[model samples]
Target: MPDLGETYACVPSTERGRGILISGDPKSDTILYTNGRSVLMLDLNNPLNVSVYGEHAYPATVARYSPNGEWIASADASGTVRIWGARNDHVLKKEFKVLSGRIDDLQWSPDGMRIVASGDGKGKSFVRAFMWDSGTNVGEFDGHSRRVLSCAFKPTRPFRIVTCGEDFLVNFYEGPPFKFKLSHRDHSNFVNCVRFSPDGSKFISVSSDKKGIVYDGKTGEKIGELSSDDGHKGSIYAVSWSPDSKQVLTVSADKSAKVWEIENSNGKLKKTLTCPGSGGLDDMLVGCLWQNDHLVTVSLGGTISIFSASDLDKAPLQLSGHMKNVTSLVVLKSNPRFILSSSYDGLIVKWIQGIGYGGKLQRKENSQIKCLAAVEEEIVTSGFDNKIWRVSLHGDQCGDANSVDVGSQPKDLSLAILSPELALVTTDSGIVMLHGTKVVSTINVGFAVTASAIAPDGSEAIIGGQDGKLHVYSVQGDSLVEELVLEKHQGAISVIRYSPDFSMFATGDVNREAIVWDRVSREVKLKNMLYHTARINCLAWSPSSTMVATGSLDTCVIIYEIDKPASSRITIKGAHLGGVYGLAFTDDSTVVSSGEDACIRVWRLTPQ
Candidate 1:
């Protein structure tokens, strides 16, 4: 039960990481489209429960509800787009294979009868307009010099369309046999997003060059330019126009959303909305939509922020949940308030200490977390999913964790005491040692050890098994010593830890009991039922060896002092919203804990 905060926020997609945001009818309530394999429709009014639809073979890049609100169209990396009736349980209407490469963006015609899809590949990126019902190509707008990033059809048109691309040009087209009418090259960098105003009189485009331009929809002439100096400091990724067409909204990599008045006033900035989440300019604002006067923006961190144009100063509501599952967790050595988590879908998130809560750094499209080991310098994570991740505090800013992958899926992992040396992973089938990215040794265990721990001196190692046995091995040779086997619990042992002095060892059971043993005599000194309601998942001993902390499925933490009996120890109830999966004591007084609730909690222990 790893905390989700660390793993998800750290590994995110660059362009499509931020999920598509849609608006409900004319009600102004937002509709969020998210998920890796399926399309999830989240209502902004509820924000908690969601409606899911469309099981795709690949991850979805974008989804849009039909203009009439009767259908939804979604595209994926496989160049497939599916149209579904959005009203009745999202029934599938039609599926089409439009391109050979990734489908970047899609838009339904104002009448909800046609779809326009664009993308890039071997040849020129194609913008093909198709009839939704028949999957027949209606027209093709084929003059983009590079991959197309976005495309949209004018709301009221004798069939007018706009397409933006990596070539930094916004191409305008017209007709049922759509032909390129004009190409606006005002954007300095890749034009990321473009949309025609509701009235079809104006169009707005955003780019990676930290600028946005408002152009006449018909003439394709740039009328106004919004620069970083006008309140944005980073690349602008998305732009939207208000319903009345008098205001424009833009989201940027600057981590803020700004609204500009289209009225004839010396071009002054109107409203600026800073994201509520704690992130710097690099946390990209990638998706946005304006429904009525309310503005909704989405970031690379997976959190959606909503603001009202009328009240920019008020704090916006934030949405949080997992689009994936947790994989691993590692506690920081220097800062008990910080923890790293990785997910099965390859997302990494960093949790930092805060007043009543903690801040998070979520990266999208990261490799899955495989194994985790904490050291003084950083927390290292390796995955069968093919990635070696590092969360370091000294070098780069504590914004997002970085990762690299070795050749294969990591079966097991451990860190060596020696600098620049990494231990090779051994599997349950065979015991092998990998050093310097190469296999060095192979040994066989009578029974497979699922979990292992290296001694502080690096001279000895202890491996635990599913057979309820502990095998102690000497690092110098393959020889092993069978330690005392105390068989009180009926289930397999989940976790084991050695004290700082190596004099005492603790073993937790699947039945929620902990047994403290004297290492030399191999005698069980204490048998404590710490969690009566749930199984114990992890255990940790204080640095001073005065107390022991145990995390359990009951969502509670208990501190057992060596001098005090287990029954009389201090208990911290409700330590995590979900079952606590891991715990670490940085010192005698500070403890860090992570769990399935997607949160890491830090507590201070004093003589009370």
Candidate 2:
């Protein structure tokens, strides 16, 4: 096995609609957030640099750092909580089944010795508190008739607990052996979140009723509600208190995050950070956290916007990335600085180096984007919805997207390197040739088309079928004329690619075999490139056309050189946590891979 050196990684973004808890370490400049089955630790200073902990077997719901910042408590949809080391190397210390259903939120006590896990527990209690190490019961969280949504532990002495839930109630608990004290019904609708002030003097609760109510932290008594005359026009999803406990911030589905100053019992509006857009679904603010001097809020589209607490009038620095599995990746030949990626969900992001998102293509009904190709000044994308989209590459129209129905789902898309206006698409029923988003020709190749490739000169095309055959065709004006059908593969062909210089081509199949073939002779150049244990999902050819790389379902990447066709292959085991689905070479020594984990990693290869 060869050592895999990683140069950069872009982790998955927070999911939409859900109010994910963002926990910041009190002792460091790191924040913890959950996505799918992984817990991610992101550095605040360099947001792109992230460390992933992929131990959770179920969809992770919430994660929190201990007060001492030595350990982290993370929970999943299965209601299991795992305490692990706070260091980049996540070593599990202990595990406990705290609830029967999903755990929506987690909170650690000020001393870092106890935790409260709360959410919907089908037949059991909605909230539970226990010692961090021993898992011994420390308190009882009772009296909520519905699922709990949020929980908070007071940061000072005479520890107190506050929780809000779908039942429209706020429950308070007290003591080392904490017991339920009382419940406050101040909101008209479901309570969405609850948080204690840093000073432990007061707490605030926000709800679907579009109201924010303050309460005495110790006695569970109601204080005056925050002035709502000019407040949120939509449900308030999250609330965070300032470090000094004198102010609070609330984010709402109305596309706004507002900061308020607390004056005795009432809060007055101070500043507003409105989401920039047309106030659509993607602009809805879902989660927020006030850690140190940063005011962070996550949108329904999974963009994390950070603002300076002391200067809310300034435009926020937004972090944008994918929150779902990336299905396709293509670099713009006209502008290498922009890399375009499409995901399982209909998100098309144009990434610029160092910056998160240079721009984004308008989403198409939230369908799955299956394949992507760069054609001239436009981006062509095929989707699970059997539709093709064309997007502009420059100026103010960069995000505008126009679509056309292809009648059947497309499996793959390939661009003709020299012919900028030509592209080839493989569909379930047949092969479709496009001249810049316009269907030039459609050929029912008499078999199930699984993969395809087009020649750089647009003079020929190759279609791979499930029957282990490659049908070669000559491009004639607006149609494909069959040249010959080669039968060499033993399994369904999964991917096909022509070398950049058009000297040779490579094909991978479901049987995990990669074969390099001579273009002119149509003979096998390397037939024994078989090291993968699972189906090959993607393949990329080096710029010099001397080496080929293949990514497989076994979560490994193999680089095979044409010179040493038999013995000198380099292997990168576990290149992606999940199976790798997309692979591309930026140059001769750099490759980028994206996978089921929704993370895109750049690897620096030193092939010996």
Among the numbered candidates, top lDDT falls to: 2
Q: Candidate 1: lDDT of 211?
A: 74
What is the Cα-based TM-score of model 1? 0.59
Q: Please give, for residues 1-608, the per-residue lDDT of candidate 2 as tens digits.
A: 44333423343345454566677874677888877887888777677667778788898888988888888899999999999998857889999999999998989999999999899989579999999999999877779888999999988889988899988999999987889999988788878889999899999999989999999887879986888877999889899999999999999988899999989869899988886665788888888889888898888777778888978887888777677777677766566555677787877776665554665676535567788877557777788888887776664145567776777888888878787678788888898888776888888888888999999998888899898898889999988999988888889999999998898989999989889989999998988888899999999888789889999999888888887864678887777777888887767886767777777766677757
Give each model's whole-structure lDDT.
0.66, 0.82
Model 1 per-residue lDDT at 473: 64
TM-score for all models, in order of appearance: 0.59, 0.94
Candidate with top TM-score is: 2
Model 2: how large is the Cα RMSD against the reference? Answer: 2.4
Residue 13 lDDT in candidate 1: 31
lDDT of model 1 at position 269: 71
After superposition, the stretches of candidate 1 with alpha carbons farther than 4 Å from their true spots are 1-28, 227-231, 264-267, 321-325, 328-448, 451-608
Q: Tell me the deviation in Å of residue 362 in model 1.
A: 10
